[model samples]
Target: MHAKPSYTEAQLIELLKLKNQRAYNYLYDNYSAAIYGVICKVVGDEDEAADVMQEAFIRIWRNIEQYNADKGRLFTWMLNVARNLAIDYIRSAQSRKSSKTESLTESTPLGAPGYTDAIKIDHVGLNAVLDKLTVEQKKIIDMAYFQGYTQEEIAEELDMPLGTVKTRARAALMKLKHLFV
Candidate 1:
């Protein structure tokens, strides 16, 4: 759906190899949007996508010298750079977010005598919303979020398919999001 480049790509690459600023400018002018599009698709957040795009460009600029025509076009190489950076950024963000959430959960304790759980305040906040959620949703939410069970664990424990568990979890979250927001 995109138009072909007006400039010969090989010429741009040759100039790029020589470290020409104009060639870099031309490359950005012609391909920044496409690269950003790829990043946005992976990150699914505009602000984070912008950050990933900036990092991707920095990586491409530094690694341009390693690109070879025999492997593929300069454009493809640059596209890979952007996509990989975006995916890595997303994964790292998820890791950090999960760690923080676990830490918070660990600090919470179930007040029952001789019964200690990582969750402290889950009972207070989640109880109000439980009535609003479907049976399946409530079960999934309890296992995954409250009871600290993984998707695979839920599926195996309940004797259901993993895909079904995931789909149900997603639907449950959507329902809760609609209810709360």
Candidate 2:
């Protein structure tokens, strides 16, 4: 059996306030295994528990300043964060699973009218405006919004610097906004 940790909750809180790595590591050493066990109990997978455990600690570290002695105990706050993260992860996995099932099985026709019909563009006018844009701008905007590529992903895919990709995307969006307005 391992020896019990010597640091008091107040001492650990002070170390955390100072952003001391040793204090953080000590907290992790003392608490992470227990937290991971709780997460595994909820999530039923070691991998998911590990991931949620990391996320929980990250959130705890980031929000250390928000912790209050008067509100509750430190361990209580930490456990709450862990449990919440595990629950959120499970819910997100379920949502993704349902979305995949819907996508695979649903049979919405191509000509189906979605709710945004009032905002729908005339194909000819939309094509004309799109033709006015530079190819680089068009490609970046299409990938970023329509295809859901993040700015960094777009930059890496296009072999361009990340800042250039962001600037071009913003400019393209501005141009599109002006056209729509």
Candidate 2, 77-119: lDDT as tens digits = 8887887787667657757676522421231222222222222
Clashing pairs in model 1? 108-119, 108-120, 109-120
Error of 2 at 181 (Å): 64
Clashes of each: 3, 0
lDDT by residue for model 1 (1-181), tens: 5554456988998888888887788898888877876676556566887898889988888887899999998898998888778766755775777752353234223322222231456445555676678766776764564345578878876689999998999999998988777
Cα lDDT of candidate 1 equals 0.71
As for model 1, its CA RMSD to the true structure in angstroms is: 14.4
Q: Each model's TM-score, in the order given?
A: 0.52, 0.51
